[model samples]
Target chain A: MKYNYLNGKLTIYLEEELDMNSCKIIRGVIDGYIMKFQPYELVLDLSDVKFMDSSGIGLILGRYNLIRLLDSKMKVINASKNIKRMIELSNINLECVQYE
Target chain B: MNENYIKIESKSRSENIASIRVGITSFLSTINIHFDELMDIKTALSEAVSNAIDHGYGQEDTESIVTVEAWIRDEEKIIIKVIDYGKGIEDIALATTPAYTSKPENEHAGMGFTIMESFMDEVIIDSKINEGTIITLTKTIKKRKSNSKKVE
Candidate 1:
């Protein structure tokens, strides 16, 4: 997971399969940054993510909660058709995270 | 038509996960699984394996083996079983429910079973507390096969 900060927004770029291991590392890294920088907006760039299991859903849900606690907004960008379907089936609110 | 089977028993540690997907892909690819279907199976299959490690074994020991088996049934469908001999679920019905995780502190979304059911044609789970758990996943793959290989 690579992250870039621009204009008070943090954009996280995931380029690999987001599984349990990756999720753990990302949580640590992102949480550390959240504690330090406290960005107002977070953009999850899943355009490069080829595969994600249920754990990936957990990552998003967990992050959503964290960001909401900080009064920040979180958006998912460029999720593949596959990831989008999984999120829909989970019954999570479609409007909760934007997929563009 | 072609048929084959693969059985691998490896440690439940996170480090040994790559082979599960690699082996499944190699096997399903031979039978011509569609790209979309293949991607679905890979995600579902990993979720099962991850469940076996997280729930079944409780991540207590790194040596316990999680057994994964796949059978290509006459080139028509693929059957996969992920088994672990560790602590099992007391109530499978509740466990299968969406958003129910035994390990919420770990951020387990509890969508493992849900994802498996969505991607596969069928999913059957059997568990015995303190004994083990077995998750069976089935999916059909035929789009890449030639007309000559069609059966029935």
Candidate 2:
């Protein structure tokens, strides 16, 4: 639910369930950080996220698109097995980050 | 009355979605189902709830209610039902099309039905315009092999 920027990277720390309700806030925060920092890389830290739905997938894909536009790299870290499976099922690269 | 059936009713808002996943997981676990199968069920449940909130409830008010029911029949079939009373879909066929979203501005890919279909054994949708939508999903657990088969 909270996002921060540091060391040329935008780190989004998510808590609770990441679904349709939270996706709007997530998108807004990510967009604001991307525009303000213009970081060369965007890192999503999901250690605190207990659950994620397809809307969560949409959030990731939307950020991926934004990163592509800015010529930056995007990675997700600390995804649970459930989250990882959802990401993989969506055809996104599973090796893009080190799972914790 | 089956002892394995589980029911959860919460606001159609996104915050209550975890209840759906928890409900499915508990039902699956009681039957000794594996984690992978549970994840598949969780994914399908997530999609159904998302559709209920985003499409059914229009994702505007968090006060709307969404109901989810899960149960296992004869220790073989898992049935999950997600119901929402919202604007409802006038065209069920058009609404379920992959990559077709009513709210494209939110970057919705409209793959909820597709994901549900891919994960569950069968999907049934019942809805009436301006009334509500009910999504029923059924999945059968595959028997586990006792022999260990290692893959390279």
Candidate 3:
């Protein structure tokens, strides 16, 4: 639920559990930020995610699609091994998603 | 091989997920389940609860209840059952298939069952179209050689 913009890149530090609950709250607010800042390269930091489900995948994909609409790219950062497995077992399209 | 059990019934609300996580994680942590194993259980629990709230009640009926039962069968085994008395899936086989979800529009990748299967040693989904669904997840915790029953 937090983001930092530096050097024209937006890095979002998600320190919350990326479950259905956080997704709901995040979905409500992301658009506002997109409209306001309109950053092209976005990084999602999930180092502090306590728990994640399929909804977490949806959140990333939804944001990916959203940023895609803006002709931007979304890169992932600090994804745990379990989160990586979740994303890999999810939709094949997301298999190409990068993590750092 | 000491026995411990906990049963939790909560309204099908997303907010309650936190409490469920805290409860389960706290209990299992006391049993010396490793951090990664705890993460696996928490992830599976979230998926199960999410299924109950989203697929079961369609995330609308706050009156409906989601039941979670956890049984520590022994030092090395844990069983959890997540049950929902909401609309159940007609095809269990198809439902368990990878990338199969009725709520793709909502960004569900149909990885709930996939996740539960990966994290737990066994996952059994029992459902009937009108009755309800019960997903039983069993994980075998890696046995740590310790006679200390109390978490100190």
Candidate 4:
């Protein structure tokens, strides 16, 4: 995971598989960035992600809730067709997060 | 064609998830299933194996073994079983319910079984408390009227 912060907007590029193991590693790093930057907006870039199971949903929803608690906004961008399909099947009300 | 079987046994480690999925995917690739169909199966298989590693063995017990066995029968039906010898699921109905994770602190959405159920044609779970859990997933490949693999 790589993140860039500019003008109160932070974008993180996610890559590879997002399963239980990778999610654990990612959550820690992202949370660290969130705490340090405290950016008003958080954007998750998923263009490089090749595989994601339900754990990816947890990662997104968890970050959504986390950012919301900090009075920040979060959006998921560039999700692959298959990744979007997995999120749709979950049906978790992620209204706060945007997908593009 | 006769039935083809492949079994993968590995320790319950989170790192092994990728290789296990790749192994199963490679095994199934000998057939003519569509790309999306293969993706669905791979996702379902990942959920089953993740459940075994995360919930079944508690992620800390890497010494235990998780077994994955897949077989293709009748050239169209594929059946896979993910087995783990860790703490079994106490309630089958509740576990399968969407958004029910035992580890809420870990941001677990608890959609493992649900994902498996939706992607695969049928997901049959057999578990015993303090024993283990065996998840059997089955899907029949769609017969294409044309040579193109795209479903739409």
Error of 1 at B137 (Å): 0.9
Per-residue lDDT of model 2, residues B91-139, tens digit only:
8898777667788788775667877888889999999888898999999
lDDT of each: 0.85, 0.79, 0.82, 0.90
lDDT of 1 by residue, B12-59 (tens): 986567678888888888875668888888989989999888888867
Docking class of 1: medium
- Looking at candidate 3, what is the lDDT of residue B18? 82
Q: What would you estimate as the lDDT of candidate 4?
A: 0.90
TM-score of each: 0.93, 0.80, 0.89, 0.94
**C-alpha lDDT of candidate 2 relative to the true structure:** 0.79
Q: Candidate 4 docking category?
A: high
Model 2 lDDT tens row, A39-94: 88888888988767778878877888889899988888998987776666666544
**Best-fitting candidate, scored by TM-score:** 4
Report how closely model 1 matches the true complex, as a DockQ value: 0.77
What does the lDDT read for residue B134 in candidate 3? 94
lDDT, model 4, position B132: 95
The stretch of ten residues in a row with the least summed lDDT in candidate 4 chain B is: B143-152
lDDT string for model 3 (B1-152, tens) is: 68899999999998998899888778777676777888888898888998899988987788889999988876668988999999998888888898888887777768888889988899988998878999999988884536657878
Q: Considering the true interface contacts (CA pairs under 8 Å between chains A and B), give the fraction that model 1 also has.
A: 0.72
